[model samples]
Target chain A: MDNIVTHAPDFFSNSQAEATKAIARSLWNRVLTSVCVALSLLTLVPLVSIIYLVLKNGLPLLSWSVFTQLPPAAGMVGGGFGNAVIGTIVMVGIGLLMSGPLGILSAIYINEYAPASRLAQAVRIVAKLLTGIPSIICGVFAFAIVVSTTGRFSAFAGGVALAVLMLPTILLTSEQALMGVQSAFREASYGLGATKFQTIVRIVLPDALPAIMTGIMLAVARAAGETAPLIFTALFSQFWAKSLSEPTASLSVLIYNFSTVPFPHQIQMAWTASLVLVAFVTLANITAQLVFSKKH
Target chain B: MTEDAARSSATQTPGRPDFLTVRNFDFFYGKKQALFDINMDIPEKRVTAFIGPSGCGKSTLLRNFNRMNELIEGVHYSGDIKLLGQSIYNKEVEVIALRRSIGMVFQKSNPFPKSIYENIVYGLRISGEKKKSVLDEAVERSLRGAALWDEVKDRLHESALGLSGGQMQRLCIARAIANRPKVLLMDEPCSALDPIATVKVEELIHELKQEFTIVIVTHNMQQATRCSDKTAFFYLGKLIEYAETQKIFSNPGQKQTEDYITGRFG
Candidate 1:
């Protein structure tokens, strides 16, 4: 009671009250700051350990042959995984070709053309649901559609599966990026006598390009590492991919398959393949930030 | 500019031919009506200011001239708004061509996040003006028209986002006038500007009136008096009184108009 009475007038002035408040704020800040820092450090542990293991196990196996030859037979160790690298690129390229335009256009329609309509709302909800569905389910879907019809596993089927997995991510992220564009810009464009199509094509899309590219890169990176979809759709091949109609090799599926084999050489190659997959994903993200951000 | 002289002059001015006319206009957003039974005539090559408190439908009436309010979904209107004696709402009149003749500036400074030069020529480019020399000349002319050329001429290619708030607003004005529209609608163009910037914009408005018909919506009573030739006071989405700028400020005929201008109540 005495302390409260002593500080009453100073409280109105806020000088005396502010000093105590500052001290308490500093204490709370220190505690919360340490807690957040500790949580961040904890989050880094899994990522650091994964990198350490990949580097430790895969560095000795790295060679020029890794990019130039086919994988060796079960117990032998002289060849490399040029086939898987090319197959991964081809599948991912096809996935991008199929999903990129479709996803971006759908996002544009949802955001710009019919944002508040029931159809757009339905598309948005389904896109969200698609993202949450398991990757294996996407593989099963592609298998049911393409593999069952063709009676064989092919890179085309794998690409379709991967594209299905990428579609929801690209759609969601592109919608968010396009929506981030200020309504003022749209109004300005409209005020200047530009048609809706002209405004979207010339102003809205260009402004959202950097963010849209980031979304595409992230989607592609996720598609590149997908293992379940490719296993069901592409199956596996030891030879270089000759056509989109044939079974194709991929880094993720190869790692999953070879890591389980009893042979020592195949297991070592699995680690190398995992390292390469990680490198590809990292390079994709880096290039996206570097290249697209420059335009902004 | 005296009170009695201004009243007679405004009363006689109503006989002049109107450039834009709104007749028994009613506007709605979905089921809720926002404007009710508004009728007014804006003269050519003159600054007609709409002064009212917030949500009084001043901006709504301005937007009708260019059909900008149609951009919002579920907004419908019942009225005939004629631009140069032709009904703008007619199905025969294309919205793009209508907008090309009537440019607008928003209350907020919304310069595109592009370069200064690109911002000015955006309208022209969309209309298929591709000659570099033509675009370059338009850039200088529009910037000069908006009184922004001197400050921005050195960095025409720099991002407009790098400009100051006042500069950005001026850039928007430059962009709007680049199309050389017959009528210009400014929705509180100086509301977001500082006093100095506000004065500069008012000066620009005075000069622009010689070339284009201007309808301004403003909350600032002094701005309406300073910049507008004819002043219309709106209250509760109704036009209470409109007269010469001098008469509206000095001696309003309606109690509501007098109360609003004197700050007794909004």
Candidate 2:
């Protein structure tokens, strides 16, 4: 013990140098931390400012009449894009109906049935490429296919446009969700003598359902907010759509039309429509989060 | 009654009949060979244990019994594995039907995210048995067969995931046996369990051998001694020795088997 005490003084003498090194490291850590915090706050600026601006300008025009009444003539007052809101909902619903089952079933075939096949690999590459295509091209494609054949713009054409855009999102996300299901579950099912179809339907799909729902909800939000595709397909209708085959008004198209017109009341209505669209997207996102959290 | 009499009289010992016979079996995963030429006759109504180090091909052989390895992209085998007198790899043999008659339990406990009752009756449901009374009876019987009915009876309607790890493993056993398969393949069933749970599973294995032909792959040498009637020791994808469990542990024929059991080296 006495021999150890003689060496302890040397250990204490180097403590000052160790303290200096620690201070230098901590200063660098603090500087990096501040820079990250500053950058992250900067990213939030656009989102927060948009929300603040929309609420400030849009709140005064938001009323029951805005939801109930139809759009008035140019330079007139006291009207709402009620038909446009309904048209958006109907068109997105139609797109979901068209694409939801197709995407999910194809994903199941790709992930569970033919995961390693060359054809499945090719399909996956094409689906990824489709996601990066410009939205306006989808509008043009639908115009060529649906509008030219039907002889007029219609909600059905708008739905086709939206479905094309939503397909890649749903397919890729569902594929990822299916892949994320642990292989242990499938192995256990197969061990118990389940057929491949039975194992996929009973064990794999139910396990991946929540994640698939989240993907669908995200696609729904994106489809609802799209503007360019609706313009070339659905076009704009001053009156409510009488049928799916007729021209339809949508909130995105209304905002596009009304925001640029030389009238004060129409401009205010556009801001109110923007707020409603944002709310719809927010609600869909919240639903997705809720569904995902319930699984845990 | 006459068939039963003839079958009983054919074998002098209770567990002497060859239930599963493997001859010159070689297994490969893609280009990599996982098991060398192997031969063994696993007896009916007896527990056979495979003991080896990691990557020694014990688990691979166990999976081949039910053809579970076919789930991989590129796995192939040579020679043949026969259940009863029929080759399981025959062209006409449906792989699904072959698997139905031979059940399996994995090393890690994996109960589906479902009610305990549904988990146990999963096999029956897939086989098209939907009568409520029959399903309820099977659930009770299988859980009792696994010695887990008493602890989980009241919670049969609850999610199987809520159970402890040991309970979940026992649940898996119940599910495997729900179809009343002729053979049960267990791959290191108690490796993830504690000592107490291991003892429970080992005891269950002892009781299970009276009805099902069991083939187990385990790294625990003591477990083989405790629960198995026959033991096969392997090293480097080759079967080093096969004998009665008593003889293998007390008087191993090969130097490698002795070195492995005595902790000289794996």
Candidate 3:
């Protein structure tokens, strides 16, 4: 087959003009490739610098006391953000619990049950709009809802704000995940005598589980690091929370309040809390990857 | 059944029962017509294959049997289809129940991204069968029915997606039969398989007809001739010819059917 093959005279042997043009084109391609590679690396600079700065300032304050002791008052030097860490965990946990089911169910309704209707379209638009809404506005909205009702800044209020912030991310990611599932799986389920709901719950959900989980983990991580919402709802507490109605000391809020203070010790503790927040978010992401990779 | 004998016999004799009857059935995808004025009776406990060129609506007609076409948006149909002398399109008929009695396997093998055991027992589990022993037995029975028991017996707990293409298709067959459907519709089930897997699935279909009324749509003429008890030749949304498989292959009554069988035109 190779022996019988023929080539155009100009294909194997180019004229001087064509050869010069090809060389110029190849040089242009090399320049373009290098530019693209440089631009991609340039985008990572901000994130790498942020991590570096946080680790540089925060690692010095990482002692056992940070986990065991409470935030000290003005002029104190050696205290930890124990209450803030616990508070961040509780509020984010509450937010996840609230958003997970609602987001997943809405995604199912949009992707499986009512995909063609105007209502689903409207819902999808609203979800996209919600994701674009600033986190501070979510705080204000939660502040209006919870503070007007209960007359206090509380961990529950913080949770409500975070849940609001998390819902759209969860909904959008989960919807995309559910959409990623192959139609064949749903068809197979329906072919086997399963109802629409049965097909969704049994086959579609399981198939999209990895992606859905990644979405939920992303939402949790986003919720954990959010400071603006906590400022309005959780406020700041120097002590551990005694009840859901009391002001909570989440890590993000603690960092926000302490970083602004004149005390050097409080600023040092704020950097430490920032590092812990990054570590917490990183852990959630890693867990999501692990769950996503596990075979069903 | 010899071609001469089956052709001489024809179809729908005075005494023989028709398990499924389609009368002047027409189907549409939005404004476009897919199946036009189809009329036939499918016998019970036999393999009926629909052969046609691509997009000739053989698969559409098969999907109409269990209302699977309704899953697609903008699809509508007219005329009545009956199962066991009762209208299937009646308002009183629940589609879920209808599908339970009529399983389907697609051209592509689709197994749940789950364990082999879970894939087989999915139908039973959805129907509220919670007994461990019963589920375990069903897994074995269904896998055996699809002729995949020996290959996957040791690794029943393994992921169905991990199986080879042929094994995955067989697992889908096993999943379908686990529901013990009265009718099984296969839409070009072997189109993606290699010749060896195709032969295996063809043999499985032959054995499956003993327990289920099997309807298949295929592009492969040899496959239609090899396994089908009845063959319906479709052309451009019309049923050109339908008769015993032997007659359709050897002595097609219609000129078009003969032309198609002889590779004159699609």
Docking class of 3: medium
Query: TM per model?
Result: 0.93, 0.94, 0.92
Comparing 2 and 3 on DockQ, the stronger one: 3
Candidate 2 lDDT score at position A62: 94
Superposed by TM-score, candidate 1 places the C-alpha of residue A107 at a distance from the truth, in angstroms, of 1.2
Per-candidate RMSD, Å = 5.0, 3.0, 4.8
TM-score, model 3 to reference: 0.92
| Candidate with more favorable, higher DockQ: 1 or 3 | 3
Who wins the DockQ comparison? 3
What local distance difference test score does each model get? 0.90, 0.91, 0.89
Candidate 1 chain A: minimum summed lDDT over ten consecutive residues — where?
Answer: A5-14
Q: Identify the runs in model 1 with alpha carbons over 4 angstroms from their true place.
A: A1-28, A294-296, B1-16
lDDT of 3 by residue, A5-36 (tens): 23333334345665566678889999999999
DockQ of 2: 0.69
Per-model interface RMSD values are 1.1, 1.4, 1.1
